[model samples]
Target: MSIPSLLSRRAALLAGAFAVAGLSRPGLALGAARANPVPLPSADQIRQDYQQMVDFGPRLPGNANHVKFVDWMKREFVAAGLRLGPCESYAYRRWEPKRWSLDIIDGDQRHAVPTVAYFVRSQPTGPQGVTGPLVYAGRLNPDGPASLPDFPKGSILLFDAELPKMHLRQIVHPHFIHVRGETDADVLDSLYHRLWTMPSFQMDDLAARGVAGVAIIINASSAMIAGNFSPHASPYKPKVPALFIGQDAGDTLRAAAKAGRAAHLTLDAQWVEGDVPQLTAVLPGESEEVMIVDTHTDGQNFIEENGCIALLQLARHFASLPAGQRLRRSIVFAGWPGHMSGDMPEAPGWALAHPDLMKRAAAAFTIEHLGASEWADVPGKGYAATGHNEYMNWPATAGPLNDFVIDGIKRHDLLRHAVEQGPGYTTGRVFHNSGIPHVACIAGPNYLLGIVPNGHMDKLDADLASRQTAMIAEIIKQADRTPMADLKGSDSSLGADPIAGTDSSKRTQCQAS
Candidate 1:
């Protein structure tokens, strides 16, 4: 059967199920009664869209690929029958690294060590690079002051950095629920929170100490470390060049540092000021109130920001519907850039730019990091898949909005998911903070922020993403039929605190992750 016929059959089945359940709401009845519901893109179509997006390369803000991706999105939106909205443009200093290397020089013998990745916005080294005596500093505490050996000026510092090892049970947020996956005790070691946080927090102190350069030895494999580019959220530049050396080369580099060998460190990069655009497209509905669908366009790999493709799929579905069959509120498709740029996020900026529209918004949905497969660093072996979809978080505002999301998840069989309280991590936090009802679905796989050799293209599950998008569409339809007052409800709490209710003595010192 054709995709449209299949979708119509599915709609008929759903309508019959609702009737059998005795659901008599006007919106549900109207949705069920429609003879020809617009067809949602098939799983195969969504897969094609995802592949096209991955082919664009890493969509880091203000880069050539990012610009091309935005232009492509604009064209796709127009082709899907969405009216092009404003493109919010902003300027910032963009960093592009050419090449970097680290070498240990012991008298006449020189040893080249494998350098994983450089910290974004770190001070750049010239072509010749900087040479200095290597000094072993051990682990630098992110919490408080620690006694350290004094180093002479113009010496390179090597610090041992450990990535946090987490068990599934340790994710004990009040709203966090472990739907299903690996056992609770399975290690979740690829958490990159510290990779950038430690460096960002210590950059000023390192500069104050007058260090010529810095190297952090992380506990992951060379491939994993090479893919990581953490602390991408910072706008400030550090004074000294910095590099991340993976665990494969850790002992060698550490022994060289302890041996009082001279090392040459280079981070050949430059910052160029440029403008990046944020896009918004509108699909007019029967009423003036709007339901905004948002996602960031900048990321490191395929799964990082694939939400825009999902957004495109949704735009096509809604646009194909007959005008009379459309929802009561207009739908705004927003694609914000600079998510990885460390500048002020474009979501809130767009919200602030159009206050009148914000007033008319009934609710907002932000989607990101969809269809991610869970992967973790294995001891001795390297990064491998865990054969399950990453645990997804659906954080929604308290009240009917939250209930609607849960119901949709159940109806669509979106397993391995959690229904958390409002305003988790995505750009949807803007709507939650501004008193607009909001819900966002996002997943954080180990490779979410990493630019890997395969581009992490293998990490996406097209069928899973299609089901998730369909659930969102169902929820939007339900919301369109329900009264605005019922959807918003009366709850005022936006979200749960990151560190609230935890014991200070037992809590991890660095909570940035």
Candidate 2:
């Protein structure tokens, strides 16, 4: 059945709730009323689009599924009567992991322990694998390898690094500073200030020392592994294999190392030059100033697919409007595939290829996971990814743009929830660094970004998605109405500092290490 038909049936079933929420009454969603010229999207439409993306399975690079989804998107855009730009095409080197397993060979028995995740672009440990004594590298030098003591050259070095505790703290204590009337940027800044103080591991040190491999332990209770989205494009090159292991596994490895035990590491992953489509659909307006609405088209599942659907919804909405009724500023809808590959210039993605457009953009509205389940920690149960009343993280560029989003959230009566972020990379940083106003509203417990495995929208909150999409549409409308100078802000030093306490100046855009 057609999506509109399905949505019409739902609108009838939930007419009362829509009325109470001040949403258009019944048939108004189907056949537009005389009140509003452009009908706001119904919850049913958002849910349907999200499900369609999920049905396509994962859209990660180096897979046939990625190509399939990209083709599907192009067809959808053309159907919406949008124009694809020549700069949409992008290619990059992608890694394909055939067999990735690590086991501790003790005496005659092997214990299979969980690891955070495999490092991106890490060299494989050959079919035979490398077995060596485990060595504790202690805290990584704040300066670098030059400040560290020497360890065995061929040992598997293990060390500890701080995980993003701000989000976790919000989940545990929501009443702390996550109250209403506060911008997400303010809340994030409060939490992320300590992040800059933490020591960062020098991966180059491992390669320089000729260590077989290295493992990092993030100080988190959950066993989720987090790492750079595009490790291969990182400025620092590592000649050895590396992975992030949870605290429990790290403790075990440290104990084993203290007891003079050995570890066998293996990473059967390969990296080669590959190409994936990067797309952009332009809806021209009367003015030259352009507003960008984008999201990554590739991820494990709903974590990013929901964002893509939002982009599609925006495309459909703008395309439906008559050219004369279109807004003043042009709108560019971007669907980037290599966003998972670190979104670097060298990585063959949108940001690297479109510097002129990036610089000229007045404001950007980036959509990631819209309606995601929130995760919580259970004392004896470990981490549990549950709850429908979860909050989203909206990281906006500091200054007037952030002020505008905060005011809009209240004006639109969006649900008051903490804006906690997860451990994943995004395209927001790139735009922010270039002094472009950017806003991102993403849901919590994103499993694709490695919050934890098994976080899905079981009882999908269609209302939340609708409200979020409406807010984004509102932001775009306001951007179009407001002058470019006002939306872009006057402060040149705003995005010069790295986003959320990470030194992104060194690494290419789109890193969450």
Candidate 3:
């Protein structure tokens, strides 16, 4: 069957599912008479959209799955009655690993060590691989001296790095309001923020030291380690092959290194140069100014890049409205790629590329990592849910944008959420930095960067996601009615920094690290 036909069948199935779930109520259709306010997409519809994106698998930039998802996103936008805008394309280097393995050779005995994942953008070894004497480097201290012990040339270095123990309370900004379920005891023990920090810096140092390969002993469970593409920033691409060895195998690997054994490391990968596409579609309103609704298309799992689905749902809601009820400002739905790979341009670059759109933009809204349930690795048990939604952050520019986000949270009963200052870690930070008023909702779940089993479909809360998306929809409506001068308040009137207690700048590095 053709793609459109298949999509039609899927839509029918979804509609049937919604009816069975009692969500296909009256006044939801585009032309239906309304007793209530404009209806947002049902939780079931959001889940179906999210599931379709997850089904596309890991959407690393320039990869086949990423391209397929971008195509689907464009088709969905068109189906929602939005007209397509010119898509911006840029060149980027794509990496794909074929096969990789590590073996410790001690005298006559050779022991294989299980690897969780390869460091993305790490150098690849040939078919013969690289065999060299193992060198054991101690645990890395981020604040410690920036020096390493000398090792023989072409040696495979083994090092340990502890994933920082974090709690939801510790990371919440000072301006957080209506905080819920976050206590000092709530441990966020997964590698959520560690994906880009010390690992990449360590890799860069090792590569500079002429190491043939590196084995990193990540102090986390095998499940957490699995599919973790560390050192994911654009900079700090390691020239030496590297692999993540889980803590379970750390003892054996450490022993081998101590015994002065030889280790063989192989990371067979290929690099392809391709074009990364950033898509934009517009829903015309009564006015020329546009509210840029944005989200990245590239990510590892369901929660990581599911914002595009939410964006789509928002588009559907606004587009379904009657011509008489349209907002004052147009809606520009933007889908960005390369959030995961970092090889392609991000929001800042996109803004520079689309000067005309940026010139007309009145405000911006971004949504990502929606409806994530809190999960952590228990000492005795494995990774499991904590019976609470992941703590979410709404960082909006100080003004009507900030007010709208807080008001929406209260009105929607969006539990376990905090509202902070503008330009937090959301992909839409570029707008806030560019003086375009913005508000964004994002959660830093442990599995957001992990692929496959790590960021599985079960981690999402469809109801919560729908509610969050609904709140965003309302915020957009409120922004539409507010005047541009009121939305963009002066810096002097913008009160104390909402991120006063926290290092908002460091948070950006946490994403780019």
What tens-digit string does per-residue lDDT give for candidate 1 at 31-140? Answer: 22224644775778777888898888888888988888888888877666565644566775688888888999989987888556787878998777899999988785
TM-score of candidate 3 on Cα atoms, chains taken together? 0.82
lDDT of 3 by residue, 139-201 (tens): 654442255677899999887877665544455455445433344234233323322223453
lDDT of each candidate versus the true structure: 0.70, 0.58, 0.71
Clashes of each: 0, 1, 1
Candidate 3 total steric clashes: 1
On lDDT, the stronger of 1 and 2 is 1
Pairs with steric clashes in candidate 2: 116-225
Worst 10 residues of 3 by lDDT: 504-513
Candidate 2 residues 266-328, lDDT tens each?
777776676666666665555446678887777665565577778878877765665455676
Could you tell me how far off, in angstroms, the CA of residue 488 lies in candidate 2 after the best superposition? 5.6
Q: Which pairs clash (backbone N, Cα, C closer than 3 Å) in model 1?
A: none
Give the C-alpha lDDT of model 1.
Answer: 0.70
Candidate 3 yields a Cα-based lDDT of: 0.71
Native-to-model Cα distance after best TM-score fit, residue 446 in candidate 3, in Å: 1.7
Better of 2 and 3 by TM-score: 3
Q: What is the lDDT of residue 491 in candidate 1?
A: 56
Ranking by TM-score: 1, 3, 2
